[model samples]
Target chain A: MSILEILSYIGTFILLINTIIYSISFSFKKEAYSFFCVYLLIMLIITLLTTYYNSQKVNNLFLSHYYFLSQFILLSLFYKYVFENKKNKLLINTTLILIIYFLVLQYAMDTTLFQIFNLTEVVVTSLPLIIYSIIFFYQNLNAKVKFIYINIGVFMYLLCSMLLFASGNLMIELDPLINKIVWIVNASLYIVFQILIFIEWRKNYYRKIPKSS
Target chain B: MEKELLQEDSQIIVIILIAIMILLLMAVALVVFFFFSRKKIIATELEKANLAISYQKELLYSTIETQEEERKRIAQDLHDAISAKLNVVSLSTHVLIDGTLDKEEQAQTLQHILSVTTHTLESSRRLAHNLLPPILENFGLQATVEELCDEFMSSKKVFVSYDINYEDSLSKANELHIFRIIQELLNNAVRHGAAEQITLNIQEYDKKLQILFTDNGRGFDIRSIDKKKGIGLKNIESRVDILNGALSYSSELGKGTTFTINITKT
Candidate 1:
């Protein structure tokens, strides 16, 4: 396999392993992390199905819609729990509603767009998550900031990848070599994101759960 | 349709590249902003904690210094009041034992010994009383304060007008703090202010106690009252701190001084 394909496979496998680990560790507490674990489970399943459809030489671009929408909804709820802001909530809800309405309108007007990466979905979904992470940091300037490592991971990954994802239709029309390079950069950033999550778990969430639990 | 889409593709890619650069720069700027602001906040917190620790250390050092000074004063009193007089009585007894005097001389020596011994005994009793007054232990604060006012009027040559309506009985330890506060203020008025007339009023209402003390002395400026130079003031401040009480004082340079204190019944 080429390095690009190999990197993609590695990211998928790591996501699977991390989801399993988090589910098991967080099952006992059933707190904020329980919702996070559910997000992880959904993400892992979607990644596997997308990889499988790609190997079968079939169209799987439609999966990106589910990926983006589920991610936006679950992670929005997660952040809303972490930091309560009515304004942030309103922004997320309004954006999600607007994007869904626009996408449905586009689908009714034309059906051919489903065969390619929808640029509107990529831009609108990732933008709020980016803004939310920044808001989290801004609100906790003088405090002992919590969930910082995870936030940094999300902020970095989403910010750099948003452009690559948004430009998907344009990228397909360009040199295949450049497209592969973009995927390689994305896979590497995903690895960095996972490493940050691991560090957060080790530093803040490591505990000797009892056997009875 | 295909030619038009192809024509727009390269233009869109160029725009995407520029946009990506802008986003990456924003990300870098944000991280730097959070890092520096967090560092500044944590530094200020550490500074505040250090300031509190140093203040506590200074109060503790002054309290120990006051205790040592009190011990030294009591030791000097023992030497001058009791020790010197005993030396004279010892010398007189030795002269009597030598058997070189006639009956009238022996009688005279005995009388001298009797008077000296009595004076020395009284000095020792007064010294012990100064350490912990029996009047305070048995009669409680009110009776003790009344006697203290009479003693200050007669012995220290200060006219003290004392009025009190306090009714709540406190723990002995707590009462001792109140008594010492009164004693220290009275001593400062007599010795430092050279006050001839002092007025003290202690009133209790709804379990809240207030003490108003004023003296017609050559008062120093209250704004210039330095705790370091006056251990007595530090002692009073620390006592009030222990009792969770509030103390305030005002003075005119040559007119007089007034002190007001308030504390809970507890």
Candidate 2:
């Protein structure tokens, strides 16, 4: 196989492994915070499937659906977990309802309206969700060490996604160096978030010292 | 389809390399952590074992000396009290048997001799039993505890009761240590507390064994007693410490006193 094909396969495999580990961690203790783990696991699985389909050269409407839906799902899951739980039930519920509404709108809007606006509203609205996650990280100081690492990762992801979107909108062909930076950031954020969250979850769950001890 | 997708973006190869590097970092961190923690755990266990061995040696020396001293005291008590009394009664018996006397006078002398002989016998038996209850050496802790309760009940002085709920067979050394602890507590209750009622309980659950002793007595102020009666309490505390157990005391003046020790079976 060519280097590109080999790389695509390796990336897809890593994504699958990350999903499996994330799924296991999410299911281990069934804590309220475990919602984040489940969300990450789902995102990883969808990412894996999309990458595999893209690598296999099945570029079609399904691939586009997979691409947008996974991103939307991931962003929604992230926000819900960051600020949900009993303490912020009102915030959590409103955010969740809005997420579901936007997701349904993406799929159910009139063909003419969709053609006119395309996915512009969906993409634009996601910026605030991502920013809110960063804000939530700042607000939850007890979640500092864990959230700081995640904040750096999510910032990199947001930055790259925005740059890619802006570049696409302008119909500008960016230099290879910019492409390389985006690629590195995207891949590192994916891998780093998986590892960091896994470690944080393990620390919160399995490594607890009993009161007796 | 394949051609169009490949032509679109060829940067994914860089992403793959970056993922591999992150995985490598995590694996390295995990291995280092495992080795570091494993080494520390082993060193800690080693230190603990060494400390326990040294503590055991100190206990052994102290216990042996205490036993020797106890044996000497018993020997002196026998010689001074019971033996001297018995020797005097024996000489009196010989004098009374040899004397030529009338019937009424002979009967009076014989009655006196009989009373003295019986008293000496009773004193010797009581002293021997106090030194080491034969029941304890023969039938183990349970029978001895029951014997103690029976003795208390018969005397009608202290209302003492005992219950044993141990399922596992104890090693001889363990049983002996537990027996001595109970013996000492009872002595303390009788001598100091002026206790009217006392209870001893032994129970085992899961991997733990517990012994509880409670007494209804004119209990002393723990803070005040602790200052003066330090040695007795210290001995109890150290023995429980050696067993890697916990010992707790709850007492109130005019209310009651209770001592409980919980230890691991293994």
Candidate 3:
């Protein structure tokens, strides 16, 4: 296989291993572990799709469904982890229904369901994140390094996703160099945010033990 | 398409500005809430502490008053009964020794003086015992408790048993306090409980000591044991508290009464 394929597979394997560890750690009720698992699942799916697309398997509808569905699941899970709520059931169900409705639409579009995919992609990529911005707004005067990290990361992801979507998958016309840069930067921010989420979880978990001893 | 992108960018900027405004308002409100509530909480806690301190002061004052009143009563009793009798005996003895009289009359007078002297001595001994038992001061908790039990048993027909796991070598003050507590409890058992069989046990474990007393008697309603009326029990409780110890009692009518005290020593 090519070097890029080897790197994608290796990344997928690493993410899969992280997913397993996180799934096991979730048994202990660690939010970080669950968040880690969700992120790893997203990354693995993204890498798998990229690998398939490179291998000339772009026409497969199964790959298209797998890609959007994984993103939907990953986004919802990440949203729930950061902001705990019983009321989120409504939000989650609505988002899932929207994804399914669009997944069926992708079949008719015949161009690999890119537009309907964008609908889920844009919202999942932005709205909940902007909802998180509410916290920063409320905490206007407070110093929050984590909030800073999250806001920057979300902004990066939003800019990159928007650029990618606007180009209509025509990388050469939209500047393929910019697409590569956006991809690398967004992925790096995602990895950093994942690490930060894990660190926050560990801090809270350790806090649960009594300090008196 | 360009217009739509520009509109979206403007909307995003507006949303960010709105979010910043909202969070800023929330933070200010939170600080205000904390500032007011902290003072309220502190004020409430201070009020509680003051109230408790006032109640404790009232209790201590009443205890001192009760002790003084008891001392006054004992002093009056001694002067009225024992002292008067002693004066009479002294006059009679003086008359017998100084005046001439028949041998038989003199002998009867001497017998009368001896009986009066004996009764006066008994009354004086009882008075001293009420103040502080001599046996407890001389021999310690075990000997004093045993002597008290024997004395009460002989008079009241109450069977008493004393058991010790380890001999206590405590300070004089501690020994005195423990003795007083035991004495009051025993008196209550005999007077109110009408107890027939009483058992007292002293045991030492680790760095603490325990005193357990059980009586098979016609116990009273434990629920109705008012501190105002049950002065003896209250005194025992206060002593336990002062020692930083624990006291527990359980009793049921016609069943029995059990009192346990656990004291940790330095």
Tens digit of lDDT per residue, candidate 2, span A1-213? Answer: 544445545555565664555455454454434555555656666666666766688743344344544555555555555555554545545656786686568558554433222355436545655556545544543322344444444544554454444333222243454355444544554565555555554555445433453
* Candidate 3 local lDDT, B1-266, one digit each (tens): 96675566555444544544454455346445544655666677789999999868866876887698788979897997698888989888888888777889889888988898898888888888878888776777788878888888889668888886656657778888888888888888888888889999989888888999999888767778753445567678888887778999998889889999999886
Model 3 segments beyond 4 Å from truth? A1-213, B1-16, B90-107, B226-229
User: Where's the lowest-lDDT run of ten residues in candidate 1 chain B?
Assistant: B5-14
| Local accuracy of candidate 1 as per-residue lDDT tens digits, A29-94 | 544577677887898899889889999998888898888888877777678767767887677677
Clashing pairs in 3: A137-B23, A138-B23
Candidate 1 error regions (>4 Å): A1-49, A59-146, A156-192, A198-213, B1-4, B10-28, B89-114, B222-229
Per-residue alpha-carbon lDDT of model 3 for A124-152, expressed as tens digits? 54455445434333433332233333333
Among these predictions, the greatest lDDT belongs to 1
lDDT of each: 0.82, 0.62, 0.64
> What count of clashes does model 2 give?
0
* Residue B168 C-alpha lDDT in model 3: 64
Predicted structure with the largest TM-score when compared to the true one: 1
**Candidates 1 onward: DockQ, in order:** 0.38, 0.02, 0.02
| Global Cα lDDT for candidate 1 | 0.82
Residue A40's lDDT in candidate 2:
61
Name the runs in model 2 displaced over 4 angstroms: A1-213, B1-81, B102-115, B224-228, B241-244
Order of models, best TM-score first: 1, 3, 2
Q: Residue-wise lDDT of candidate 2 within B172-193, one digit each (tens)? A: 6677667767777876787778
| CAPRI accuracy category, model 1 | acceptable
